[model samples]
Target: MFPNQIGDFKHIINTELLKSGIYIVKIQNNTKTYSDKLIVIK
Candidate 1:
């Protein structure tokens, strides 16, 4: 696992560890859900 700094409340994905590609990101909580596509270029 990589290191992350704590903020209000969120996911801090370290892009430096990801290669050039397209990925899907999704997150859901008690009353909400979120989704998005992430593009990483190196």
Candidate 2:
């Protein structure tokens, strides 16, 4: 369950999460589908 055309949304999340010391687990894109997972370690 993901969204299409996630370029802008993905950019925003990447910027915010990177500053917060989060790691991007994986990104899945199937045709017009897109999904991503993030992890935060303290």
Candidate 3:
């Protein structure tokens, strides 16, 4: 249900729902490191 590219993953993160105001996240990659969070306010 998600793309394999980092950019696409970022897009999903920005658009996906988190109505409870908290999310448990994980990222799997060896070549890059992501150390930030994307918050969507609706």
Candidate 4:
């Protein structure tokens, strides 16, 4: 898995190497934490 540390929370993912499945995204800050799930379709 790759982690991003950019100030702006924007990313470009190369789906070419990813298979269709369920993925989890977790984001955290000093005040709050967020989590989400993503479904990818090929």
Q: Point to the candidate with the largest TM-score.
A: 2
lDDT of 1: 0.45
Least lDDT summed over 10 consecutive residues: which range in candidate 4?
A: 8-17
Clashes of 2: 0
- Where does model 3 exceed 4 Å of error? 1-17, 31-42
Candidate 3, backbone clash total? 0
For each candidate, what TM-score against the reference? Answer: 0.29, 0.33, 0.27, 0.32
Best candidate (score: lDDT):
2
Q: Candidate 2, after superposition: displacement of residue 41 in Å?
A: 6.7
What is the model-wide C-alpha lDDT for candidate 3?
A: 0.47
Q: Which stretches of candidate 4 lie over 4 Å from their true place?
A: 1-3, 8-18, 37-42
Model 4 Cα lDDT, one tens digit per residue, 1-42: 655644534333445424445344445555665545354644
Q: Which has the higher TM-score value, candidate number 2 or candidate number 4?
A: 2
lDDT (C-alpha, whole model) for all candidates: 0.45, 0.53, 0.47, 0.47
Please write out the lDDT profile of model 3 over residues 1-42, one tens digit for every residue.
Answer: 545467434322433445555433445456666545555444
Ten residues in sequence with the least summed lDDT for candidate 1: 2-11
Q: Please count the clashing residue pairs in each candidate, in the order shown.
A: 0, 0, 0, 0
Model 4 lDDT, residue 28, Cα: 53
